[model samples]
Target: MPNAIEFLFDVGSPTAYLAWHRLQGIVARTGAALIPVPILLGGVFKATGGSPPGTVAAKGRWMNEDMQRWAARDGVVLAMNPYFPINTLTMMRVLAGLEGDSRFGGVVNTLFAGMWQQGLNMADTQVLTGVLTAGGHDAHGLLALAQSPDVKARLIANTEAAVALGVFGAPTCFVAGQMHFGQDRLDWVEAAAAG
Candidate 1:
């Protein structure tokens, strides 16, 4: 994937959501493919003794303002979900299950928008159903797939692999084996791709 960016993400991360959208523009500009790597952020934190920046109250407020600045600068919509730090076990399982499906990208976009753009609580079973159904997916089927042992295993493996790669948080990108964290480092990612 020298010509691609392995995008490690969690559906619950607003920064990763912003990074995802900017990476789309990077794909267009650099012609570098985005290899999506869905993982559980909670697992990463547990394994690495790391935590999201929002864990501290003042840091959380500052980070909110910072996130808003990034979103506005990137010209993407981002409203902080009132329910921050949601349990995304089921949601990430669904993403991992969609790995090879043709609808994966659309589904990812829908889920990201549902969480960040519209500021919906994606952890809610009913809200998720409405989002998926409105996004043209058979909600019941996807939910069923998420419960499969294989899908659950895949997410765990991905999370472990991420930890192995020194990935301490969401939106970690690898370009030619160089790791860059955060959405603000997208220029370096683009430069790595162009190389």
Candidate 2:
């Protein structure tokens, strides 16, 4: 049986989006199941004392350049979100609520592209609503579901589980029980999944 690759992700991370974009091809070639685990990056940061690259001016500049290089190398469209460090709590909650639904993949793609490619400021509820609605999702329903206690709890649980698994950053992947951090580590992830 092929291995199941667990992708622990937060949409706020551009590197996570890059990893996610490449993971589809890896999964297809390796015949591995891609399991998406939605976690709050902020929660993980707080739990693990992890800080965003933007916290340091030089690191943030370097990271942006690196992301641009990766995007060009991958031939993927990635624009730096003008509203950097947008709060994604509600969006993550909505993703948690949509888990297992057939529309989950579409929702993920829509949100990722909206934030990373289209420069949508998803941190604003009104902006998110418009973007999601335009993407064919029932924005009102998703927003309502996101506010539900169950969905909120699930997101919290996911974040806690990620921390327990030693995930200090976004775009962490698990292949055959081995943890791989960052989009740059995806080659190892593909090799592990192929085994």
Candidate 3:
């Protein structure tokens, strides 16, 4: 896994979605493999006693505006989810279940695109199923798999692993053990990957 970029993220994070797009460019440029580690932002927050900047009214407004600017700068479409602060427990479990399966990336793309690009309220089971079906997946099967014991454990472990790596937020990247936090830190991430 040397020269690999470990992207610790959650689909619920707008910046994580942006970093998800930007990191691929670095992967293509550096010939470094991208490893996605799906973790729960709420779990991270609970563990770290760290609150998202958007929790405060002023910070919420500023972060929303800033996120839009970053999206425009990166040529990525970012429609803020109408159902912000979604409970991603089930979604993350589905992702964890899909890990190592060929369907993982597609599902990740589906969920992130659904949540961040299309402004879909993924909290609704009906909407979630429709989104996955549109993405060419067996929605019910995936959701069933998510309910299994092992998949739930994997998500918890991933969050713990992220915390152990000192990740307080989503969009964290580590190249050769060097930590680069935030979507805006792509430069340092690329440099470390190249190094």
Candidate-wise lDDT, in order: 0.92, 0.93, 0.90
RMSD of 1: 1.2
lDDT of 1 at 148: 100
For model 2, residues 44-121, the per-residue Cα lDDT tens digits are 999988889789999999999998899899999999999989899989999999999998999999899889999888
User: What TM-score does each of the candidates earn?
Assistant: 0.97, 0.98, 0.96
- Could you give the candidate ranking by TM-score, starting with the highest? 2, 1, 3
Per-residue lDDT of 132 in model 2: 94
Q: Write the per-residue lDDT of candidate 1 for residues 1-195, one digit (tens) a residue.
A: 337888999989999999999998899988888899899999999999998898898999999999999999989999999998888888899999999788888989989989998888899999998999999988999999999999999999999999999999998999999999998899999999877
Please tell me which model should have the higher TM-score, number 1 or number 2: 2
lDDT of 3 at 48: 99
Give the Å error, residue 182, model 3.
0.8
Itemize residue pairs with steric clashes in candidate 2.
none
lDDT of 3 by residue, 107-131 (tens): 9999999999999989889999999
Model 1 lowest lDDT segment of ten = 1-10
Model 1 pairs whose backbones collide: none
Model 3 bad stretches (over 4 Å): none
Assess candidate 2 and give its TM-score to the true structure: 0.98
